[model samples]
Target: MQRVRVSSQQAAVHKLGDSQMTLSPKFRLPAARSTITDHALDFDNSLTGEPLIPGFPDDVALQCLLRVPVDQHTSCKSVCKRWYSLFGSKERFFTLRKVLGFHDPWLFVFAYHKCTGKIEWKVLDLTHLSWHTIPAMPCKDKVCPQGFRCVSIPHEGALFVCGGVVSDVDCPLNLVLKYEARKNRWTVMKKMVTARSFFASGVINGMIYVAGGNSTDLYELDSCEMMDPKNGSWSPVSNMRTHMASYDSAVLDGKFLVTEGWFWPFYVVPRGQIYDPMTDNWENMPAGLREGWTGSSVVIHGNLFVVTEHERTKLKVYDSGNDCWEVVEGPPLPENICKPFRVNCWESRVYVVGRNLHVAVGYVVENYEIATGGNGKKGGRFCVRWETVDAPGSLFDLTPSSAQVLFA
Candidate 1:
């Protein structure tokens, strides 16, 4: 096992360098939906302050251009220098799209070269169900990463990759790579105060929270850290309740919930905790909910959903109010199929990527209840419906994270 270590300087934000926050004047006022079709902004790109497009008004032209699908954005960018500058600005493009109600959700899967083992990310367009390539992660030797952890910032078109192993030698790194959805590129971000692997991370309210990973040995560290994207700086988060590695994590009710691990044990023991940013403190997780969070999890409709690690046969949800695991009983997996290679959830839908790159999108068919024998009462049950499609290729082994859903 690889381990890394860094000191926890609480209540302190590291000043690595100057912030990379860039602002342009053109994107200042967002175009209102009421005037999306009727009018256009008078912003000028020419030397004499003339509107960008020759025939139509600039805002009207931009409104039409923004309606173009994201896959065709690069083609639009190549028309002229002004077009390139307008489309290339991640903030402007996404902002205009949001104003026009054209926000689309996509699934990002980080897969590796089947033969060479070179790691890269693929974007699955949920609208069209097509596969597309994203920019390669900036890793050492431009090869696959080690001890890597990724968290998606959905509102903004970006994903963050923190601390990964640099090479086969297990030389741990403190690198943070940021991926911009609009730009289709990856750029390095400010370093994490510490370099560690297998850490638990989540983004809440635009701030990135990371906790618990290894440092220098097999032991897990209790230290934590947070990053502010606005300033491109890293700050130390409050330490965890106990020094234990987290197997899976999800946010619930504005709190980051992490669970299922041990503190130097031979047998499996699930230790869980919750970190509330409002208070910047950790608390012990409830009993029943803590035990079964041993697999990949995502937050859907303000509830914690899990895809079991052993078989990925059934979908499970945790009812925090009652503190119990409720299984979504529907169709079982095919006899020939095994556990999924990756899983993610968005809104009411859950997506699973099978070993052969078979994609199954599951959603609740209807709401009903099963008759429980106790006290003449009924229990909650979900009838999940599945839709399957084949993606481009098979996933490589040693993937650190599963697929993530993003709205761009």
Candidate 2:
């Protein structure tokens, strides 16, 4: 990749492979043949049209504009329609913006688009209350099965989205999709251990573990498997006893915690159970969640936060060490989130995104606080404010309940 900087004008041209990209006042982008012509457009509408907002070097101004959040950049577009026009066309600004990384304190969300009936993906920057669309992967194989929910696993510098579909009645897709930010592309990875949807998956160390989801026949998986990205193969890890069909799992205290979600009983048996990978055994955590709490659940600060349509004014928090359920104070969701759905936790926050009648809604993303009030004693209160963001594309079952990545 050869990069050339032309000093004749305000902006510099980046030469990569055979493509030449122009920057500054007016961007004279290279043609399809990777050829650059003298013809160019000026940002300033002057006689000669030197440049708009001069004095600052073109390179510096480009960098600053790129620094602004992409979601907020939409507002910048309204400031000057010309500036908005530069977004999709200019190559320099796009290249620089992608590299900056959306490492803001936020939760990325993906919902099943009822209008198109395809999955709609987005990321929410909790701090800024912004939304950006993430492009979906090109499912060339058409083998990518759909599960009920989507999960995102951040690997290397790319986020891997996999699993889930409303109707996996036929050939379910167990394959995973990896999205690269720099390239702005999605590539299909290896398949998961089993063909099931509505299950939970978490990432620990260098492996991805998915547990307990119904198959095409609506048969729930009893065992969990681990995937080594290096080998692109699945290996046996442990089996969960409860056979929870729609439960959530997270890595807590260096071990995985699977909670909430539910199972259909044959003889009226309790459907929920919690499992610890270290011990390879499922233990009944707290008694309150026995009825099967749905929605989304997350494990933060050694406590479990479960939200559902069943309960809105309060959030259920379970103490891992003591194995006790504590009611925490929190605001009710936007009313749409109380229905059955999947929840994801990232950076001490919980996000719930689900669908009803194929229409997606809920707390696209929000921060969570843990109030310590259990056993007639005031424990402690911890809160984290979060803003929503749109991941680049529609993702399925990226990361299970408790498994999440925090950029601090």
TM per prediction: 0.74, 0.63
- lDDT of each residue in 278-321, candidate 1, tens digit only: 99999999888887665677777777777666534777778776
Alpha-carbon RMSD, candidate 2: 9.0
- Writing each residue's lDDT as its tens digit, candidate 2 over 1-32 gives 12244457776564322123323344443343
Off by over 4 Å in 1: 1-99, 142-146, 261-266, 333-340, 369-379, 393-400
- Could you tell me how far off, in angstroms, the CA of residue 203 lies in candidate 1 after the best superposition? 1.7
lDDT of 1: 0.68
Per-model CA lDDT versus the true structure: 0.68, 0.50
**Winning candidate number (lDDT):** 1
> Model 2, stretches more than 4 Å misplaced?
1-53, 58-60, 71-102, 140-149, 154-157, 165-170, 242-244, 260-269, 272-295, 334-342, 352-408
